[model samples]
Target: MSCIGNCIDHACIKSFHSMIKRELVYLEKFKTREQAIRRIFEYIEVWYNRERIHSSKGIMSEYENL
Candidate 1:
């Protein structure tokens, strides 16, 4: 069985962090905390949820699951 810890059972969250770092965070520069927040919000709500395809979901976005 998988052990439960901060990240031991949260592989998807870790994958998300890695993906965001690779695909969004590393490519952008924010001058303020608000800007970063807004951009990350947009990335998750607008891009990641509605637009980007997930391999695990087999060509559909998370939005389609709802």
Candidate 2:
């Protein structure tokens, strides 16, 4: 359980920080909080986990090999 928690924490924080820096934080204008939340959710669920290729996953998204 502790190992799982640690892994989850690391993945969540690292992904969140990267996404914020890549999108919202680097954007010129501030979007509404709701829009930000929706976009983040879409990026994580639709793109990062499903569509985007990850080198750590041998260049495939989690959904592809799973």
Candidate 3:
């Protein structure tokens, strides 16, 4: 059980990192701190966490699974 929990946690972290890299860090150019913050928040809250599909969850968002 503990191992499963750890694996899931690690996977979640890795997925988040990948999402950040792919969606924000690599895709956009931000000239100011506020712009970066707003973009990151929008990607994480509005898109990645809310709308993006996860293969592990049968192509459903985490919010959807919950």
Candidate 4:
């Protein structure tokens, strides 16, 4: 595993954090920790992987790119 701030082999980690911050963290509030966890899971597994378009990957979702 790579440390946070170390992007040598973890550009994907930084990119994932940036996407989560931009699309979810800065945009919503949760009443409970479980809610936040669930939403984050859904955001990453469903929306980000399946739906969101990434410009760096030619407007394709990670799943699509793969």
Model 1 lDDT tens row, 1-66: 376565668788889999999999899999999999999999999888774446565775566668
Instruction: Give the clashing residue pairs of candidate 4, or none.
Output: none
lDDT of 2 by residue, 1-66 (tens): 356647765876798788767865577354697876787777667766674446566685556679
Give the candidates in order of lDDT, highest first: 1, 4, 3, 2
lDDT of 3 at 64: 57
- Best model per TM-score: 1
Order the numbered candidates by TM-score, best leading.
Answer: 1, 4, 3, 2
> Which digits, one per residue and each the tens of the lDDT, describe model 4 over residues 1-66?
677766587777888899899989889989999999999999888887674446555675556568
Worst 10 residues of 2 by lDDT: 48-57
RMSD of 1: 4.6
Which portions of model 3 show Cα errors greater than 4 Å? 1-9, 51-66
Candidate 3 lDDT, 1-66, residue by residue in tens: 356657765876798799799867888899999998998988888876674445555686556579
Task: Please list the C-alpha lDDT of all candidates, in the order they appear.
Answer: 0.83, 0.67, 0.77, 0.81
- How high is the lDDT of residue 30 in model 2? 46
Error of 1 at 12 (Å): 0.5
Each candidate's TM vs. the true structure? 0.66, 0.43, 0.55, 0.62
For candidate 2, the per-residue lDDT at 58 reads: 68
Better of 1 and 4 by TM-score: 1
Where is model 2 more than 4 Å wrong at Cα? 1-12, 23-25, 28-30, 51-66
